[model samples]
Target: MTDSRDVVRRLREGFAWRDTPVGVFADLSGWWRDPELLRMLGPSLAGLHADASPTVVAGIETRGLVLGPLAALPLGVGFVEVRKEYRVAGEGQRDGADPMLRAGTPPGYQDGGLTLIAPRRLFRPGDRVLLVDEWIETGAQASAVRRMVDEAGADWAGVAVIVAACPPEVGERLGVKALVTDDQLPG
Candidate 1:
């Protein structure tokens, strides 16, 4: 297995920041471009929650969509996509028959808040779900995802992320583990 420190080093090497009119933007595109980092990322994140023995991995939309599947591959589990304000046809539609579980997140570093949605059928009553994402700033989305997991009757295994920028108490409450803390980022 690759050393966790090596992984962190590689992440830092690939990561960058860009200035925009609005604010500084994190350019994580490097993470996806490196083959070795891609190979190690899933296992590294999954390792954090291996003790939890999560039966399934759940990722929020966008970046989470990529990281979630990677983590799930190493754990020998399935991946579930938690979308943002996903809409479907009426309940009569076959694909839309299963109602989606929705939860509103609190204000975060980016926007005010977002509504997370997932199909009820994807999560089983006793599933141990570990949520994965690239970064977490406010823990708002993570908390909301946990709530959705609860509403789906699934067990909250924990959260795994590339960067953890949320407050210490928030991270502890959410049972979050990360590859690096926000302060560790290069200035």
Candidate 2:
């Protein structure tokens, strides 16, 4: 079975530094298809926030969707999809104006960023949630989720990521736990 060290190695080998309009971000189109990577990543990442004993796991977007549920599985919690540029059908069961729909963008993907959309009902009042993703750059996505949690009156349990490259302030402010640190990234 793959271990956390193997996961780190795979991530570094898979990802490359790319200078985007926003800034330097990791082009992580590297290990998406590797089920083994995720299998190893799930429990390891889950371990980060499992101490909080959250009732739900919310994944931010495409990457969040993959890692969130995978991490949530071992945590024995349900997974929630924080959709981007998409809306869920039958949510709120209302036409036109659904109070459940929420949309915004993370600060990290400023230029040509995708509009993120999620249902407020995905979480409930007082529900504890652990947010999961593969990478965190600016804590913008994590902040958005924190806002949603506040709007719903849910408890922001914690944030977890497979790799991190953002400033230490981001993690300190959000209390995010990353499996891989900045030094581990391929420079």
Highest-scoring model, lDDT: 1
Q: Write the per-residue lDDT of candidate 1 for residues 1-187, one digit (tens) a residue.
A: 8589989998998989999998998899888899999999999999999999999999998889999999999899999999887343243446647787888887663567778888889989999999999999788888888998898899999999999988889899999999998778777
lDDT of each: 0.89, 0.79
Q: In candidate 2, how many Å is residue 171 off?
A: 0.6
lDDT of 2 by residue, 5-121 (tens): 788888778778899887886677777756677577888888887779889999976789888888888888899888765445444555766455464655447665555566777
Candidate 1 residue 166 Cα shift, in angstroms, is 0.7
Instruction: Identify the runs in model 1 with alpha carbons over 4 angstroms from their true place.
Output: 86-96, 107-110
Task: After the best TM-score superposition of candidate 2, give how far the Cα of residue 50 lies from its true spot, in angstroms.
Answer: 1.3
How many residue pairs collide in each prediction? 0, 0
Best by TM-score: 1
